[model samples]
Target: MSENGGRRSQAQRDAITVEIGYALFSGAFAAAVVFGAFAGPALLFELPGGLETLLLRTGLVVAPVLFVARVVSVLLRFRQSPQPSQPGRTSPDS
Candidate 1:
């Protein structure tokens, strides 16, 4: 155990921050892509107003669900991964 007891080191905190940013960026990107895919035909073609509205509405609902799922999956994977050895640490095999 370290002197800080259960507290994470600065490097650990930095890793978490980076992971969080990565998750958010990727989630937003996924959401945008999903929305574009769903509503692109409506936007590009001359669809009826009702159909266009339906497509847009479906996209609006689906995008956020994807965003949340993306974020959760990424963060969960990051959390489950093994942490790297700290600086100046030696493995037992060494």
Candidate 2:
């Protein structure tokens, strides 16, 4: 019996893909909050009462899109990668 405990599966790879997506979302959301609170004034045109509405709104809308973009990039990378295969091996059935 193999140490795999059973047949190996791609569940591990799928789970990692999901985790990366979540991480991207979290990081973008955090960045939005930080920028809106601290750096928004400098990065955006000065507004009334020293507030930058455009930066805040832009962050709220863009964060999720950025998260999706990151996920797409990861999936593309996964597709482009080559899988390791046994050399000089062929099934008897073939």
Candidate 3:
């Protein structure tokens, strides 16, 4: 028994799992990079209180946004591609 009531094969499940893992990993990496870019100066240098607060807040907002964007983009792109989960769908590009 599986999540899909055993409707899909083990291979299909495995593929989906891998794709999800990839999406999460990429999202986390992108978020970390964006956060670092935004907060790096604030963290590294001794700046005015207002400026530091602004930079930190901006990083907090932007990082999450980028994370969601990356995850959704990857998953959506993956869904558009050919998959064994949906055997009949050969994808529009093909």
Candidate 4:
């Protein structure tokens, strides 16, 4: 293949990698929200607090946990995968 064609293919592959990584991360967050929302009541009951508790109680803990996990997974993917030398398809450095 010509250099230009190879470059384009590489760019497409890199873009796909980044997009799939993001999708997985987003799915994790969505799952966390749904899990925390439904399980919040029961889970919160386990916590020692009165009825004054707000949604933040559940979200605060769950959001960070989920976000951290997503970030870590995405980072891992970038680290494990070798990126192609293509323009406009740079993977995250960190």
lDDT of 4 by residue, 1-94 (tens): 2367545576567776886778577857776876678457756566445532555465666766777677777667765786566656866883
Candidate 1: Cα lDDT at 12 = 80
Inter-residue clash pairs, candidate 1? none
lDDT of 3: 0.88
Per-model TM-score versus the true fold: 0.83, 0.44, 0.80, 0.41
lDDT of 2 by residue, 1-94 (tens): 2248965457656656676777677667765665565546646666664356555666667766665666667666755665445447765666
Residue 93 CA error for candidate 1 (Å)?
A: 9.5
Predictions: Cα RMSD each: 3.4, 8.0, 4.7, 8.9
Q: Please give, for residues 1-94, the per-residue lDDT of candidate 1 as tens digits.
A: 2468788888888988999999999999999999999899899999999999999999999999999999999999998987757667867887
Please list all clashing residue pairs in model 2, or write none if there are none.
none
The candidate that achieves the highest TM-score relative to the unseen native structure: 1
TM-score head-to-head 1 vs 2, winner: 1
Error of 1 at 36 (Å): 0.5
User: Ranking under TM-score, best-scoring first?
Assistant: 1, 3, 2, 4
Query: Between prediction 1 and prediction 2, which has the larger lDDT?
Result: 1
**Superposition TM-score, candidate 2 onto the true structure:** 0.44
